[model samples]
Target: MFQRLFITHPASVGETYFEHMRASLGTAGKLARASAACLVHAIVPGLCKTTGSTAIMALHSEIYPRRFDQPTL
Candidate 1:
């Protein structure tokens, strides 16, 4: 059960548990930073003009190369 809970999905995505954890945490950090930039932009109107969108696009590009439909392990 623990393996299914912690390992199955990551293996399906071609990542070990630790690798998936690191990648997901890094993505979460990027999203948090982007959100903060957007909030600041909302108040300033001139700062971080493309920060949020750029970050999101970069993330999308990275995920686009991965095949979620195929099980790797």
Candidate 2:
């Protein structure tokens, strides 16, 4: 069975993510992103395998909403 963790930050979510990844990958561990939140694809064994494990090592889809207001038409 596989489990995922969801993390929401007011700011610097990317930085935090990279930090976690760096630590995890540095130790040669495994982690998965929560499906409900951002689509985080970790470096899992037999999954998306990578030569090195870093927080920002793998490319992930950032689903953050924009703060800018829409222009009136």
Candidate 3:
């Protein structure tokens, strides 16, 4: 059960459980920062210009490429 719940997806993505946890947390951190920047931008239009969108795009590229571009040998 544990393996099915925790290990399967990570293995599919070429990561161990702990490794996947670390990477997921990193992505969460960036998303949190982006959320904050968006909140700030909402309050003051001049601040954090493109910060949120840029972070999202960067994260998307980082995640998407890694998921789809790994060599299968």
Candidate 4:
């Protein structure tokens, strides 16, 4: 049950638990920064004109190649 809860999903994506944790945290940090930039852009339209969209596109590019069922060697 512990393994299923903490390990399965990460393993399915070809990462160990700690690796997955690090990756998830990094992604969250990026999203948070992007969100802040977006909020700033909303208030002052001229600044950070493409920050949000660029961040989203970069994130999509980073994630698009990952397969959920990648075989682990």
On TM-score, the candidate that comes out on top is 4
Q: What global local distance difference test value does model 3 have?
A: 0.90
Which should have the higher lDDT, number 1 or number 2? 1
Q: Would you estimate the TM-scores of all the predictions?
A: 0.85, 0.22, 0.86, 0.87
lDDT of 1 by residue, 1-73 (tens): 8887898999888899999999989989999999999999999999999999999999999878884675444
Question: How many residue pairs clash in model 4?
Answer: 0
Per-residue CA lDDT of model 4 for 12-64, tens digit only, reads: 88899999999999999999999999999999999999999999999999988
What TM-score, to 2 decimals, does candidate 1 have? 0.85
**Whole-model lDDT per candidate:** 0.90, 0.37, 0.90, 0.90
lDDT of 2 by residue, 1-73 (tens): 1112333331233446557566546534323432211232343445534332433344222222422343322
User: By how many angstroms RMSD does model 1 differ from the true structure?
Assistant: 3.1
Poorest 10 consecutive residues by lDDT, candidate 4: 64-73
Model 1 spans > 4 angstroms off: 70-73
Compared with the true structure, what per-residue lDDT tens digits does model 3 show for residues 1-73?
7777887778988899999999999999999999999999999999999999999999998988777554433
